[model samples]
Target: MVQSLAGMMVPADIFLSWGVQFPSVLATVAEKAAEAAEADGTMVLLAVLLSLVAIYTASKVGGEFFNWLGFPPVLGELVGGVVIGVSAFNLVVFPETGGNADNSLIMLVLSATAGLDPSVAEPTFEVQSEVVSILAELGVIVLLFEIGLESNIRQLLEVGVQSLVVAIVGVVAPFVAGTVGLIAVFHVAPIPAIFAGAALTATSIGITSRVLAEIGRLSSKEGQIILGAAVMDDVLGIIVLAVVASLAKTGEVDVTNIIFLIISASVFLVGAILLGRFFNDTFVALAEQFQTRGRIVIPAFILALLLAYVAAAIGLEAILGAFAAGLVLDETEPGKELEELTKPISDVLVPIFFVTVGTKTNLSVLNPAVPENRAGLVIASFLIVVAILGKLISGFSVFGVENINRVAIGVGMIPRGEVGLVFASVGSESGALSPSLDVAIILMVILTTFLAPPLLRVVFRDEEPEAAEPDTPA
Candidate 1:
């Protein structure tokens, strides 16, 4: 429109003769305004705001439903993400502005307008993407640290062989089954298949822990085993991610690098154990010295973040570092005070982290026009079975541990919340997965997380009778 006005004008001298320059000024202002608007787009910001509102509302409704159904709120959170991304209630806009429905092209154009040349843009964006990614890394660290603090290290060690076996089975079975489904069944190449299996490897210990605590079984032997197995599962899962990621990047899975990652994780685990034992007295002393209000809590919080950062710096995930730090803290103090102090922080930040996960989910990937899709859904369905069965087999690991039904504990720990989704996201970002494949992983995650709790309630309902009757008469 502004160009039309400029074209219609014969000459500025005509306006000057009439002593009115308003038309020329209007044209210049309009042209500049249009140019500026095009340059500085607010599309992403608007889309984010829309998503935030939608997520908040969905979380509330989803939370209630999941809670009533005997599941964790994380299940609802996952569903909330799925609703926004895949269901009729999509919260995201295609271009996030304008009527253009081609988001991929829009993203490319917007990124190009921001000075990223197409040839160089992929690498540049991958590098810059690390900034937002640090958030998830931190979340994992904090989650693990909390687990460490809640853990009974001595007890976990006592149960080490059994827990290790469970963890190994938990990791291997799912990976093999999932890989076979992706490759033999779905016929994808080995590298991508391995990536899919890797995504299925994580077990959300946090979700399992919360549910165990809720059911007053945190003190049970079965609970202890589940917690221990989950810790090991995370350690092993990350190693798989590192190896698979390297393989995907280089097209060669280096056995030496895989061995090195495993060794590093083992070294870190051992180092954490020694440090916790050696400095436990010092930690207790420091807490005593800082008994003053507003002292121990802040320092401890700082310690968690510091360790988390250091972990990231070393190429390991921050969540693992946070968990290690928490393990090092002196939990011998009465009433689990360290955990009580940290709960407030976790309560506030953790939900935001999960909600952000929900926000990133794009549901439109289920659209029919998406390419190379059959394999993705087929693999996801197969892996969902493998994910459930692998954890279920952990129940058999309870043999010879008296008074506890290992089956129940295994079922309780089956839900894969943020951890599994994190794997899916990493795969998606690396270009190793198609959009439909990403959706399949998301669906598998949602299915596993949603089904676990209610199933657990039924599986363990029989345990009450065994508990009621002691082996020896009272």
Candidate 2:
């Protein structure tokens, strides 16, 4: 039935192109719709709307299908986006190449103008791209915020020592392994090497959190440690990014600037948590006066956005601020209320984030048949192994946490996802990394993100009952 329904939805062109014609009225309506779309400058708008519908539908179907297969739904969403995006079917196309104006819708309009007036087309394609980018950014912020809502300061503090060790090891091991391995074995340039190393330092809290949530383990000890470690990893990753970006720009690392960045990030996170705790009740009291249905949600979301903005302003990732916002709100009288209210929004936005991440992954770079790209494939493969080993080693760093699944914690930290992409983007823009190196990093992100969820499921599946069982006499 499902296959038949899908078959019916295929365009009539496939079967009727030989000689068939629509009824006159139907043809007229279709013609008029096309003409109107072309005449009123609504082509871009129509494309955007259709793109959203297609993405959401595909994401839902793919996610559900993946879930049915005993895997995390997000894996399916990512795969769905890749299938629908320019990387596969080219159904939802972006500019063929980054920063080339030739693919802009405005440029097409300008061409139609025949040089009569070039100024008429105002780069509408760029505007549309920006809009989509903003939406993707919002999706990630809300995702982190949701993760934060599920976590509390006490849980973070309780796992503080172990998490700290895990985070430090996670960051240092990957960075050192990537930098040293690339330099010594691959003979890569120093700047690009550093960018690769910096990229390795990121742990996608979004991916890890979703996997834990899917498995109903978000409140487990391993979950808490992974979450806490991811938060620390974010701070450390951003600082490393800033330092590497500076080094790339100046050809030398400035010690003072790196110190300042670290201090600023630390203060921002610590300060946000402290301030949120001190003033959470006051904000909750103020929110009580508004008797509307979304009173709690509206204020909570605004705070999340505001803090996210502040975090971005301070050179940290905006999602960090959003996470901090969640941590702050999770302690208040309205904390649980806010989570219940904001869940619907997260549900809509978070899948878009994962899908967008998928769309950005260009699998063509991994084609071994392409001789030029084979080296990149080799580099990416090596970095991926390094990436896995680096994070996996961090799990065992927790000495005192007996019976804790250190392997689960390590696997949870493996997916680099959007954060690694961000590092790669910055490096590419800075000219710090060569195109091959950038592609390698992207491939690393794709592999890590794709593999972590299933590996996590395997690690955590049987351990749940064991973890929950009370201590018994042998």
Candidate 3:
């Protein structure tokens, strides 16, 4: 066989193998290699940008589609995330989602292509990343602050027993369930399992709020209970996160640290509320005096940033500070303007946060061929069911509230939104939970989020009162 030397060429697989082997070579050629490596980083950023754009556009498109089909818009968002996440389309690379991504083909490509030249791969701030962090923070702040501002303080006061019951069940069930599941089923150590349980204790109010708003049930009595219970849940979640962090760091749970965190969080929350109330008048006056439009925005931004820092210093999340700031603003007479101004920032920052979340969901964990992996998958499903059922039972707390649909309220409380993701992220970063556990948590969040709207619609279809029948003049 006389074959010309030119006739034989490098196989496509060989070129890929070469890229994997001599990563630096691709970056060194004519500096084309370097430029190309640099280009990949740029490509990553571009992919993120495109993801953000896709999510936003998808949300809109999904919303319309769902609206037309009489389904929840959130469902559409979930579908959008899943569709983009899976192999149906390869528009964006799914970032490592704990254990699941390592098995993914997309990640295989990302790993093979990761910064070919370390010399040229120095991380730089993309406008997108900054914008994403800010919006995510702002949206969270607005959401929490709005909850505080909109809180029916008087109703909470009046129905103290009910609120406490709801909060207690909501916190205790998940905590206990998660711990037992980890220890008994997964055979994880008790301490990590406890921390895992604590992570699951926090109820994400944002999901329920959005669902209620979507179904036009936000003003109902059941809605109020859901809101109250969720706020209480957030307070509980923070306490749990602080405790778990202390335990993880010290390698032993400390009652003293728990007490200290509770005290600190309580003081911060109460002080912020009082300060906001006290300064409500002053803030209004200052807003009027400054009149610079620009002045108010800057001052507000500074305040948010300052509080966020202080919150961090006190060993709490910075998002809490932003939320507290929102509450303070809500008390001021000029709050409406502040809300309007905050919207643009939210519009810009929030989507990045969400898409960033979606980006982290690794689809490869779904593979069962990996060893001990079946246990992880089973755990994921078990956890999701436990998470859902536990929250669903909390709806029974509306014992005497008039015109309340306990079912609707319970259903409304089902969705776990950004806050759930926060817990999952904390779990992943701290190594308290493995990628398998991460998959479990994420599945719970997605399931809850996907179920809320449609379930709420079903529960509220008849508009029956939330309360059981009362005795007549007995």
Best by the lDDT measure: 2
Candidate 2 differs from the real structure by a C-alpha RMSD in angstroms, to one decimal, of 13.1
What is the TM-score (0 to 1) of candidate 2? 0.74
* Pairs clashing within candidate 1: 85-363, 86-363, 140-319, 141-319, 144-323, 145-323
Candidate 1 has an lDDT of: 0.61
C-alpha lDDT (0 to 100) for residue 231 of candidate 3? 73
Q: Which ten residues in a row have the lowest lDDT in candidate 2?
A: 1-10
Number of the top TM-score candidate: 2
Please estimate how well model 3 matches the true structure, expressed as its whole-model Cα lDDT: 0.60
Tens digit per residue, CA lDDT, model 3, 96-136: 33223333333334346653233332221122233343444
lDDT of 2 by residue, 1-474 (tens): 001122211222222332444475356445434433333244445445655776787689888997797555666777787776646755444542352235433344434643312332333343344445556667878877886787666765676788999999999999999999999998998888988999999998877877777777777889888989987787677657766765675576567866776677678877998988777877788788888777788888888989987876555567778878888899998888888888889788877766765665566766888898888888988999999999999998988767889899999899987678668756764667775677688778878988998999999878643233232100
Spell out the clash pairs found in candidate 2: none
User: Which ranges in model 2 have alpha carbons more than 4 Å from their true place?
Assistant: 1-41, 96-122, 187-192, 203-252, 400-409, 415-439, 449-464, 467-474
* Predicted structure 1, TM vs. truth: 0.70
Give all candidates' CA lDDT scores: 0.61, 0.72, 0.60
